[model samples]
Target: PAARVVLVERSPEMAGFAHATLAHPGNAHLGDRASVLTADVMLTGKARGEAGLADNSFDFVIMNPPFNAAEDRATPDQLRKQAHVMEDGLFESWIRSAAAVAKPRGGLAVIARPEQLGALLDAIDGRFGDTEMLAVHPRPEAAAIRIVVRATLGARGKLSIRPPLMLHAETGNGPAERTEMINNGLASLFGD
Candidate 1:
């Protein structure tokens, strides 16, 4: 199962990590099957022909887009502002970008704040359908903090909402194996 992986990062830091990971000698076996592209997909996604990203070329695309539009604060940190705050239709732009590269009858998945569910669906609009959603709660009976949605391109079937995924158990332990691995310094979401 060495499925080809294409990582597109808008942030320089993320892009660097992806590039290094793919290019590292440890992963040299992947060779041309993996790629890391740095671009602001929202603005230039349609014009990435030079990057060899052709239209409807991918079987599936997954995205985690910025959900906040905290524009009123006027923060001085331009990078943080650009990363968190959203201009009008920014979510739509990201969704459209993903749809443009997804193959027909393929799939798209997005993870975003539970509060942004409406916006997420609206962003995909008519581009994708047959939506399925899973709510992620921090604890049992807790309100959902995040939502994971998957949909098929060009399929307009009725939407289905699945059961929630509780991160913490009733004993208050979170993702047992992952937590243990992290505590042992054997696994991490961010690497050294």
Candidate 2:
């Protein structure tokens, strides 16, 4: 709780929702320690500086950049479409932004669709090294649907692929007994 968390989101509506949720009675404990800044981090400048974010100054950077190229959909929500639809060079821009602000030896993480892992690695190739990937699957027997890539800036090392993190039990397995510890924080893969 000693560290401050500043969330940067490009969507104004989403950023407002984050602020409102964090200020809600049940989660108000964040108090003033957490705040959201609406900005396109890829082009952050005066806004970033005002928020105390300087080039190569952040301890780490985490990005959930949009990964899907424009897709045909029925949703009428323009905001949702804008958020999910990706443009050319979006990933590269996001990776560059993270590298620009990350301190030397600082860590960076990007959550992306499984198909984009190669592009993600290429984008971070020079600015971040010692890359590792954690694949996330819906269940132990399912193929990974996404990956979380973690890297250290300015380090030299080989890439490591970690075991997949399964999010659910397989069908017909029945519900595994969950203890308070498990429900609260303990995570497992149904003993798989």
Candidate 3:
């Protein structure tokens, strides 16, 4: 009922599992609308390009790439450098790939640890126009653990830094009402 969707996985076994899981009646409607590809992203640059995944072809690019940094030089045909180096240069390749395939005015959403925010920003290289950041804190007084950032390609604008979202209650027992409210807000934002 909608446009096509593509799923890329590095493992064949995982790809098969995803295909099987999506083949159920509950998801039968997605037939022919989705495809699963088993390919190592770091070594599939040519394949990706051949598949018409050229620059500015997508409306959005979302990824949660591996965070290990010690395998950068182990592969001779890696398409991304940051895929292996968490802090060395892996993110840059991912961002560059996203930017290359994202439409000129498309958007990007990435969820990553708070510590990676600086590296993410550096990789964006001003290609992102407007950006909004949401920090997630464990408790009212605890520091942020993660962050969600939404950015647009080629659309320079001001950054909107919203207040931190607390994930736990003030009493530190569990999630409080405020935590629920924050969760609801995020759900609404994502049209859930």
* Tens-digit per-residue lDDT, 1-192, candidate 2: 786678988788999999888889997788887888887776766666665567887788988887776763435788887778777788788888788788889989899999898899999998899888888777777899889899999988878887666656676444333322345557532221
**Which segments of model 1 are wrong by more than 4 Å?**
24-31, 44-46, 71-75, 176-192
- Model 1, 19-53: lDDT tens per residue? 88888899988998888888777755547645556
Ranking by lDDT: 2, 1, 3
Per-residue lDDT tens digits for candidate 3, residues 17-117, read 88997788899888888877675444336666775466667788777766554553465644444344454566687787778778888888777778788
TM-score of every candidate relative to the true structure: 0.79, 0.84, 0.72
Candidate 3 to truth, TM: 0.72
User: lDDT (CA) for every model shown?
Assistant: 0.77, 0.78, 0.71
**Model 3 ranges with Cα > 4 A deviation:** 1-4, 42-47, 68-87, 171-186, 189-192
Q: Hey, what RMSD does candidate 1 come out at?
A: 5.3
Instruction: Please identify which of the two predictions, 2 or 3, would achieve the higher TM-score against the true structure.
Output: 2
Residue pairs in candidate 3 whose N, alpha carbon or C atoms collide under 3 angstroms: 42-79, 69-85, 81-90, 82-89, 82-90, 82-91, 83-90, 129-155
Model 3 per-residue lDDT at 157? 87
